[model samples]
Target: MSDGLPMRVPAPGLPARVRIHEVGPRDGLQNEPGTVPTEVKAEFIRRLAGAGLGTVEATSFVHPKWVPQLADAERLYPLVSGLDVRLPVLVPNERGLERALALGAREVAVFASATESFSRANLNRTVDEALAMFEPVVARAKAEGLAVRGYLSMCFGDPWEGPVPLAQVVRVTRRLADLGCDELSLGDTIGVATPGHVTALLTALDEAGLPASRLAVHFHDTYGQALANTLAALQHGVTTVDASAGGLGGCPYAKSATGNLATEDLVWMLHGLGIETGVDLGRLTATSVWMAEELGRPSPSRTVRALSHKE
Candidate 1:
């Protein structure tokens, strides 16, 4: 592990290259107790792209009343719009989509939940109602020539309703896939998922005619299982993973939810397994460290701490 590099040992039954969907800029900063400065958010996105993250979620266009942290989406988008990497923003509805589209955005994502309680809590809509809401949004985005991603949260477990059924998750995700989302990002919102549970969900989706290649896994580290669950997804043929730099952000609405899988940690494991993610671990770790300083706290990522100290 010289110079913060992991020894490559290619694994069997794994994709040669995996895409890291960096979410720290948007999903990561939205949960901060205080709003991060717009300039800082812009710099973070640039640093992530510079670290070789091919796709970086830039910001969300939700109403400022809902997420004041990202209220500066309009001001923030312009600063990072010229970046060469893909910049995807989260759009909750047509208004959000309009705001993103006005800013020349080519990629947008819609966030949905798999459980009723979460749907009501997050979107004030039931599972069916939420999907109905997104139908037009996805269609409109696609019609406008934008790539759309569907984020299905609470796939594993929910705070109010314990342990979700596999069929329940599969059903919701299948609908999202049908909405013409280029990809579905399945979320373990409360971080209670185990490896077998991860395998079972992927299998169910496959049976439902939704293959793993069209899915991305978004795992939280509350139970310290994010990395293990991610490994299970990779073994199951999922190549796209959603991770936050410095392991920042949780479900602002889900009180029990925790920080997402750290990009630094995921890159370490992927590089170790000889998978290509086109990310520079040292630069990514340095970016997280810089962000930790801006947030006025040390990063929670072990790899960030380890590699950062060496630098």
Candidate 2:
């Protein structure tokens, strides 16, 4: 899709190395019932780093009232500061960015929805306005020497809107790219995307002139298509992915939504295919087990449940 590059499919093997951005610490805890204590959150990050994840989304800097679970972001940030891994936090606005900057965050992420209805409902703004909101935040983050990652949620389909246009997804991603975001994560937030849809979207993105190296894929398993869609993206040249440990988080606003693609499951598949994620399987499993115990519930990862049965 780029100039002079044949958009042909990749060979039938996984890449030698892949980067897993662990979102279990932040995205996983956002939907849980009780507020996970700062100590527990810090331990969670430590455990994830021990599992060999290079990048971990530590916490969100949103208002406490909006998400009470991550209210102690200030406390949590400093606790993970000494870790060797890249710690990124989600900053939704100027206030959130201020908090993150105070915490000495080296990386910050901002999100926008692809569909108009989802954008208005989730961010309380239209698509264009939501895009506009991140311009200043991206600028400020870059000014502070922080790497900015942008997320385009519901890139495949929206529950209320259904069947999003590829052109719209491309436009939003391009805008985010132009805003100086170092990486742009394309998210199937509701997990309604299939392999065909995934490939088609990547093709469209490639044609739209967005560099493949700057893109990452985030999928949910609502329809059990997360891994299949990921494989499709891999074949199309995606190296970074967003997955939650134990498949922990789902959007509270979407009644039909399910948890994200489990990190344990993704790592297992990558290992089986001879791909290197640099994650310790046993430690990753232990982290999921800890989260399950903290929440007093079963893990949503099929691989976790299956592996637990053997032990």
Candidate 3:
């Protein structure tokens, strides 16, 4: 939206407000090679919400062996439990759910891959097997009065399989909806999606009985197309978008995958479109800059860099 291109009017029926589901803390830092101290992760979540992110993914309940960076979920969740934001944790299974419940988590997310290769590599199970494992986890979380979000990874393409069929994504989406997931996030994990691909997939899913309102688009910026794909999703009536602060995190199973779409970049586009996100772009940019400093690297977001230079 900010490449000096002409801005087209949003199609009719586009939502006036878009909810940004910030995944920087959980999905972003989980893959960092060096361990971020538990306290630092907690502070990062606080800063994200302070920047007006209403929903912040707090941490993952995956075993430390799998993602050693987030093994401190217990210690980290309590630190931000009192915040006025919705903090959701990623639960891998029923055990993960129990761990989250014990810590007073009000929201939890379950993940399943759209491609068999990703499922086998990331979860060590077939796609169906992974969904079967999450069935009870979703039910238990909902019963406990916690909001359950389901994530379908590799919705557009897969690193191992390549060009995943739209049917596969639709089937998995329906299954997740049937499993009682309150919302489903369709992830372009390997970042091969173009705007046309996004429009086609959303149209197919809508025809398959999955409403665009119940779906969020999660894209990586490996191909520099995340924002364009997001615009496509918005025109099709998607109201929730998942992004990471400082464009953090990538799929470990996706060797070609880069960082998730930056929250600051999304905010810039949303604000430019006259869409209300309740997020302060200046504060969000500052948070990402601080995070980049903490990570000992340059901020990956173009918006953040431009804003920093102006400052």
Winner by TM-score: 1
| Better model by TM-score: candidate 1 vs candidate 3 | 1
Clashes of each: 0, 0, 0
The residue-level lDDT of candidate 3 at 4 comes to 27
- Across residues 26-134, which tens digit of lDDT does each residue of candidate 1 receive? 8999999999999999999999999999999999999999999999999999999999999999999999999999999999999999999999999999999999999
Query: Where does model 1 exceed 4 Å of error?
Result: none
* lDDT score, candidate 2: 0.88
Error of 2 at 80 (Å): 0.9
Total residue pair clashes for candidate 1: 0
Structural RMSD, model 2: 6.1
lDDT for each candidate structure: 0.95, 0.88, 0.91
Across 93-195, the per-residue lDDT of candidate 3 in tens digits comes to 9899999999999999999999899899999999999999999998888888899999999998888788999999999999999999999999999899999
> Which scores higher on TM-score, 2 or 3?
3
lDDT of 2 by residue, 1-311 (tens): 12211233434755667799888888889988789889998998999999899899999998999889999999999999999999999999999999999878989999888889999988999999998999999999998888999989989988898989999999999999999999999999888899999989899989988856889999999989999998888888899989999998987767788998999989877776767789887788888888788888999898778776667
Query: Considering lDDT, where higher is better, how would the candidates rank from best to worst?
Result: 1, 3, 2
